[model samples]
Target chain A: MAETRQTELAHADSRESVTPLGPVRRSRDLRVYLVVLGGVMMLADLSFIFWVAPTDSILGDIQRVFYFHVPIAVMSFLAFFVVFVASIVYLVTRSPAWDRLAQASAEVGVVFVTLALITGVIWARPIWGVWWTWEPRLTTTLILWLIYVAYLMVRAYAANPNQGARYSAVVGIVGFVDVPIVYYSVIWWRSIHPSPVVGPLAQANALEGTMAAVLLFSFITFLILFVFLVAQRMALRETEDRLGGIKSAMRRRAESVF
Target chain B: MVLVWKDILLEVRSRELVISVLVFGLLVAVVFNFALDVTPQRVTAIAPGILWVAFAFAATMAMSRAFVREREQGGLEGLLLSPVSRDAIFLGKALTNLLFMLLVEMVLLPVFAVLFGFSAMSFTLIGTIVLATLGFSLVGTLFSAIAAQTRSREIMLPVLFFPVILPVIIGAVEASTRAIGGETTVGLGRWLPLLAVFDALFLVICPWVFSFVVEE
Candidate 1:
């Protein structure tokens, strides 16, 4: 009975937060505009990355990967930061919406982190002469990926949805807190080994004028895309939860009538 | 303290957890000994890594059981209903885990000493063990509580535990290397204090999260 009431309350809460009841056309939704805007900017961003940005005199066009790599790295951090904050708020407020926000951010963050890792490897294979090395930054980002993946697993194996949210909130908070410590410890451990001659990240500060402008534009483009993806994900989760609530309510009513 | 005592009495009655974990640690040492080519010339370099790996394996196995009894026997709700705050419960379990872990480590230290021919009872090595184990149990106990409620409870602990405690492994191995290497001048430098910081931060954070964990 208590759960039935809570589901009713969730029904009310989600109804206000979601779109109006009906088949909404794609063009009429706000996300369509975001998708359109993000797509146009991303097209420009990719063109600048490939053609507009001056190739490096020494490294040649292989250096162009940095345009996407750096911004994707930055956006992953932003996404996880949102997860951390949303998690704390969800725990304190006991609100499912905040947990949904955290779930959305973590899903997006995992994708961005994977992209960043792949691009870093593409840049490293030429520069460092290896596909991967346990560089402090790369290792830290990899662990961050593991930590959030574990966060998702905790939710997946949890006994119920509310328990999943509560438990994953705990994991989210601790995992974000672990990131800096992991970086520092890895840096300390790497200190005894001879440092690499150069990394893609090291050249970031020395970009030429057109290159810097193109990099700056890529950052904004990725930011819009990140926002658009997360907004889209959060909306999808809200709809899933509402539909789940409706299905359970209908099952309960049918049992009563029978 | 009463809560800690209760855990102590339970473990003392059975002698199940620490003994099994002790054999597990020693077996890890034996496996690593055969797994790696631990030449006499390379003992100094590889010994600390071996020692800490054994300890970490022991920890994850032991920690997954931290709340099994309370949960399985349905004592957690009763314990929570008593006058103690949830923080007390968290600290109690964390402290119990630390004590059990230290006991296992101390026993295996002699084995490590015989296997690697390094004096494991040195002050610096023991101090490193304490600080690293402090951080380990602090994070481990919290994850244990969360994991105990999951469907795949035992399989879930290390998945949640290891990434968070990687810093402790890094710190402990480095500091233990300095201590065992006989680097008297640079012995255990900033690594020990760094582990202390890891412990201090989690000391305040884990318990606060525990309150929300048991809220309903």
Candidate 2:
């Protein structure tokens, strides 16, 4: 029994030391991909906002909001969806990779959601004649933003690493469920925001010319950007984790010498 | 089931949660009186919303205690080790919290009526409060469980919970408004179904999610 206990402790220590190395390698590769992808998205967003869409369409100059607003909104929702899937993956597999992915996605989702809120206010000011309104979509989006921000807070303040990740995973999963309800509530209640333009039959029939082309390109560009951001953020997290491990090891070594 | 009852019995013996919630609810009702420019005519119109705000905030205080108490005593881990299903634990706590919140509401309703010169006997209004409280407590119980696992749990619970449960608040307030305005059938028609839907959705989802929140 004594020998078996000693072996188990040694095995656990060895596993802990080696685990960070795998994530570090994976993170480095992801950083390279993200940098390239983010660059492409930055350029695409610039072109769409400046050159592609007509400055004076029938929707008026307010149409400028569409370039930033739509893409950010799409990216935000996509980021949250990633959180949902990553959360499920984390819970089922108990893998740190999924946890890291969920955390990174949540952080990116917050950024996009913030942008979406800002662009929304700017759009609303010109179109609705107000900077802020208690309109359903606006309210729901604002609430969604708060939920993720709170998720971040929970993760940051958790005393233990495992505890933080697990808590945030549950929050991410619950918050994702709220998104569909928000969408549905906006539909159920009359709202100042326009109804979803991309319904089942209406989606194909709705987009015909340059509008379709620009929107599709913008979405793809944003999707790539989302992937890039998550990759970079995940890399940063891995580096932090490694630094944390190193600090603890150095502290232990110092204590031993003392 | 026995464990669930045990938690309720434990809470009953302590009585801390109930007393604090009732006192807080009464204070909120008093504040609403001055804040809303209370007059006999205007009082009836706004009374339901005021009552709900008091109950909801008070219930939040009560709900935070649900897990924080167990965590403080270091009893939650032991509870998890027991044979009770995780869902039973969730539902048990939620129902107890709901009952406590409703009890506070019951006391506050009479207090609100007396202060605002409104009637407490409206069955529809009472029903609205019941459904709304259930929905709020259900969602709150799940979130409190999640929040209790974090370091800054007490502070984080409301921040995470209130925003997510906005729909419930809206439905409740709207339904309460209809009932208070003396539009009985339409108000019941509108808010009751929404409250029921909210309750059903969270009832199914929160328990399934509770085990994941607590497992680690």
Candidate 3:
């Protein structure tokens, strides 16, 4: 009974250290509201896509993927930007909260990027007649995917959590710096030798009223979804970190007892 | 300056760093020579690509040694303990990596010229190699330092290095193509500047990050 109570106190202490200082009760309510808002918004956004928004005259129904695809791409970039900023903060502050935030954002960013790539390929097959191309946007997105995947790998392979946080923070910054250059290099390459096959008319033709509205709405909806996912990931990461701490602390105590 | 000299002097004595990199670079060239089956007709067109692939991979090996050797010898902590700033240490290691890569290039360029029938003496091509190598060295040094502290480092270095350093590769290959094909310097202008820009950008960025990787 004494040991069990001690373990419980230890657990509570670790949890308090890891827990964010906001109204803890309100956060649960906030999470619940976020899910409900996100679900309803996502459903409305889908309806706006399939039924309300007019299809492209040139590309037709397959172009509907644009609504979700573009926003996810934007969110992935947003996620990574959070990572970049959070990483800088983590380095400066050495705070586990910021590290968890950076890690969570990176993971969500990677997943969003994967979704964007899949939707891109799905759209590309019928429109571009290939599963993939070296289009500037797509190419840079691919590079973005690789860099963060490497970031995740570093985190996984690290010798310890503190080391993982430090190394990945470095990678997070470097990877962001690389993304724009990758885009520029691809753009320059394409400019030098114009690809023979003409690309989709999406860039050349601007979206009209309803199409624009739907795209904007979906982007907002996805942003909410992205924030929700990241918050959940961060909470889980904090719990895992707290548990690791308690385990090690218990181990040290056990060693002392012997 | 002393850091560079220390590394170079050590490299000259053991001769292992440059020699191993040279062998690996030569092997990449030779293997690609077979792999691409570079017929005379196809050689010039593909020459830039092959040369760069060799250079990049070879430099990766050199970069891997930059810190890994120091680490294994237990000299890294001593270097860290020295009074020099972290940036200086990074610059010294990067400069050493740059020189090692250039040495390999000086040897490999002639071989590439012979095999692919391009004149190695083209100033434009030589300029591209120098500029591109600058970018590669800066980024590679920092990554090598980062990877040195990790597991499966050889693999980690490339995974982290390649995607980031790709612009240099593209710019180098494009510029080299124009140079080796005997094209005018006008064609060389864009790609070289792109490389210079990348070098300048990362020159500031890499050393800053190196501080983080080595921070105790």
DockQ scores of all models, one per candidate: 0.90, 0.61, 0.85
Ranking according to TM-score, highest score first: 3, 1, 2
Clash count, one per candidate: 0, 0, 0
Predictions in order: lDDT: 0.88, 0.77, 0.88
User: Cα-based RMSD of the predictions, in order?
Assistant: 3.9, 5.4, 1.9
Writing each residue's lDDT as its tens digit, candidate 2 over B30-147 gives 8888888888777756777787788778978988988888998988898899898899888888988888788888888887888887777777778878888888888899889877
lDDT of 2 at A180: 64
Residue lDDT tens for model 1, B77-188: 9989999989999999999999999999989999888987887767888999999999989999999999999989887898999999999999998899888888553626
Give the candidates in order of lDDT, highest first: 3, 1, 2
Q: Is candidate 1 or candidate 2 better by lDDT?
A: 1
**Candidate 2 wrongly placed segments (more than 4 Å):** A1-34, A57-60, A183-208, A249-258
Count backbone clashes in candidate 2.
0
Q: Candidate 1 on A188-254: residue-level lDDT in tens?
A: 7787665765544558767899999999999999998998888888778777876776667666656
List, residue by residue over A157-221, the lDDT tens digit for candidate 2: 88788878877887888777776665555544443234532222322254436766777778877
Candidate 2, lDDT over the whole model: 0.77
